[model samples]
Target: MPYVFVGSVIVGPLLGEDAVFGSLTAQLAAFAVGLPLAAITALFPLTRPMSVAAVRALCDVPGESLADGPARSRTARGRTVTWFTLHLGFGGIISGMSLALPPFAGVLIALPFAAALRGSRVGMPEVFGEGWLLALSPVIGFASLVALAGCAAGAGTLLARWAPELLGPTPADRLAAAEQRAADLAVRNRLARELHDSVGHALSAVTLQASAARRVLDKDPEFVREALTAIEETTRRTVGELDAVLGVLREGDQTAPTAPAPTLAADLDGLLKRTRAGGLRVRSAVELGPQGPDALPPMVSREAYRIVQESLSNALRHAGPDATAALRIALDGTDLEILAQNPLPATGAASRRGGGHGLRGITDRARLLGGTAEAGPVDGTWRLRVRLPLKGPHDHDHDPKKPQKPQKPQKPKESA
Candidate 1:
């Protein structure tokens, strides 16, 4: 590797007085040449990855990740250039000694045998032509080789220590990377919850609807027609929900208006009717402003709809056949209250039907909207109570009335 730099010959002339000055001058010239070469090479994006690889391999650095990616930011780009300068400058000096010292030591050792081998004093230096000095020449050469070994080892240690400090990603880059991961994970979790809720509710309703239709197949055609119609509507709704979930996966296409979200104003009546058709007797009371459920924040309306939907699905699942549930939705002062109650089943269906992934889904929707939900046995009834603020944490972001300052109306420009 010493000859790899091709600059060690600068030290090849260090023996004579004239060679001493010339060697020092050439060594300085090598360092000078390295400075500009490092700066120029660092401008290319590929240079950072290459430098990281060289440091990891040649410097004996340990770790799978030396640096995250190629340098892009100004600070990282500048660091890449500085590391290149150190490599070219110090590497040239160290490699030169590595090649020159070991060989020079060999020449000195051969000095004692020069006359015997050549039949003359042909290759022997005049200063050590005879006496103990000639014998000690090999000792001096051995000492020089040992010193070179330590110097090279020390240089390598320093490079390994500096590798991460000079080449790893900066704090700002790491922060941005973590934030990106968090946002992507949030989208995935939300989609998973949506898929779970929609599919579960549909299956429960369809099963009951089909069972009811079979019982009345030869009896009342009117009741069978109604049950089949309910099944058709339930499947259609489930397909729309699936499409919306798929659209979000396509690219977070939440604003694509082709499939609107099911809110209380738009979908609650249908939900209750379908659940009743499934054989659960639901006693309902909904009190809303003249503006109806839409008067509240869109998130509040949407989440409320889901909380009730999941509650009914849980009832169909845990309340056994023909189980009756109490449903109530009303605005209580500054908060919106939704309470659902059903008697615990005699059979150990869920150990407690009120608690499961469905219950968790209800609570998650409530908490995400800056609300609270509780479910458990109370007076022999498994009751779920949820309280949500009219203008909650999520409302600020989705509030339709939240005003935005008018743009100066310049030509279209890219936003960060």
Candidate 2:
């Protein structure tokens, strides 16, 4: 119905009378004229972008001879040439209507051309497409109407003293765009916070443990044992968390939950297995003492594992292909001391820049979780230490006051 009115607007000008019957006849003629031209223009690739070699070669022919002969005889000379002439003539007529029609009539002619352009671009065939697209040709014509309206409005604004009503609805579009941008910023900030909290914490712990594992691999088997064990436990936890995060990235019907959440109890065994798979040898001695039942909180457990995983991944990236790592986790009352140490590559330039993210990510996680993470060299060895409160000094205190108690750090178990 709306389309019929738009068509009438285009032909209504061609009709001398303003009567309903005359307007209907005008609309019929507009449809009769616009459809065949749109069809011909879309069939021929008239635009520079889509014109291929063969089409270009066809277009090189001289004059209107392609259209002068019968369709049967001309097709052999070139389909593209015939189509090109047809579109050239058709486009000229549309351009003439655009120049001559009132704003409303111009809209009716412009819309269908735009629709045809869109259809051709997407490779949709025009063999039997009728109704809406055919009917909407006048809407394409209407865009010229809008261009004219804009020019008139601008001219009026410049001459506002003569016509004050020309300023139009100027503020609405600007306000909507501002609101949309603000919404986008809010979402980005939240994503940054989540990454800082999770991935960051894991990387830091892994770095520390890997350094420890490398130091004792040959000189002290018992010490190497602890580091290797920690590496495995850490890697497993990291993989699980990574899977969770990636699952969220996938778009589909929600998946059924898979592996259960990382348990609060120390399950560094899973972490150790994964690190081993990545080609890092682990020497670990991890014991969740009698108070071990008091297990690390779920957030701490997952983070602890991530710390291990990222450190080992870094080790693989930085450490020599045959590098070994050590890990040690011990409970001293309410404080959990995690130490991951790896040998400084014989050359000293071992995994310099490569290990930083795991270090930084772990540091961010530790800080957020009411803990402190630190990394770097000590006595020719690379170490990562993350001190997190298991329970706390005050129930809601900002900082806990505990003297850093050094442990009787043991040796790693010799590889069988």
Candidate 3:
């Protein structure tokens, strides 16, 4: 239809009244001039989306076959132009056949009956025809109409087959979509880690505290009340961190709570007390520089707090009841060192070595910050050590996870 409208303006002036019956060569020449003029319009960005929609509907193409977005690249635009040109050419041919062929066929079918109705012999269509051969004219006309119908159906099939190849996502579009999927997966994974560390640690503490209070409730009213108090604090803090973790999902919403994530600067003291509530004896020495934990980068601090929490959670779970664990956090040069060690519980020697998903999450967290995590039984005790750079993961010339020599805790360096 577009070509028909445009061609009238282009071929109409050239042929004047002969537009319908122009000489073959003259018609071809006019079409040649008008074809490029029509095709050039397809290069516009809007044309790709419009043609994609039209092809899908009119050709009955599957929704997945054509891309929904507009032409965004040279390759996509080139394919769109080719498709649009084919659309115009085939539409013009089918339309012309629909208007002219059926009536012409009908007249030929009626020609034989004309003489019979008039009761007088009449001359047939000639290159000098008059007898049984005249009967062949109607048959030929009917066949011509059938051929036109077949051509139209075949053209529809051709367009449907080509629509997917021309209109589907380009390589660039596919790549962009893939990157978006990866980023979404990364965010979901980080949330999972945070939820696990926060809730798991809290649950372990509450369970231990409840059991201790239950056993001593008759003879030790004071201890039971303290246990209940710890349980309340742990649940309340866990719920707050849980909400912060879940906020990642509602990030773009106006109604989302703006709770800050857990970090060492704010949560380390509470974490130590929570570990003690879980029936693990914790002896700790944390010496950050004079600038204190608040001087660390937010990402480093947040991930560091989780790493410590998970390590302690592992100790609480696998180091058995009432085992003393040593926790040392110190700033050593440009690196922050976290070392957690405890005697392997008499019954948990093998189990302590296999800390499962919690240990794996800790390792991933440290690696994400370009740090290293090493946890295993050292001598007769289990040890978990991690090293993270204060400047985050991007500053180092070498891999932060690379194995380095074990160093004893030293006096913290003052921040400059």
Best by TM-score: 3
Candidate 1: tens digits of C-alpha lDDT, residues 208-266: 88988999899989999999998998999889978866666766454665466688988
> What order do candidates take by lDDT, descending?
3, 1, 2
In the range 333-388, model 3's lDDT, one tens digit per residue, is: 88889998878878755445546788888888889888889888888788989999
Model 2 agreement with the true structure over 78-117: per-residue lDDT tens digits: 4434333443434444544455557445434643555554
RMSD of each: 9.1, 19.9, 6.1
Residue pair clashes in candidate 1: none
Local distance difference test, each candidate: 0.76, 0.52, 0.79
Clash pairs (backbone) in predicted model 3: none
What range of 10 consecutive residues in model 2 has the weakest lDDT sum?
161-170
TM-score per candidate, chains pooled = 0.69, 0.39, 0.80
Q: Which of the predicted structures, 2 or 3, would earn the higher TM-score when compared with the native?
A: 3
Supply the global lDDT for candidate 1: 0.76
Candidate 3 stretches greater than 4 Å from native: 17-38, 46-68, 107-133, 253-255, 349-355, 392-416
Candidate 1: which stretches are off by over 4 Å?
1-23, 29-88, 94-158, 164-181, 213-228, 251-258, 348-354, 396-416
Superposition error at 252 for model 1 (Å): 5.4
Clash numbers, per candidate: 0, 63, 0
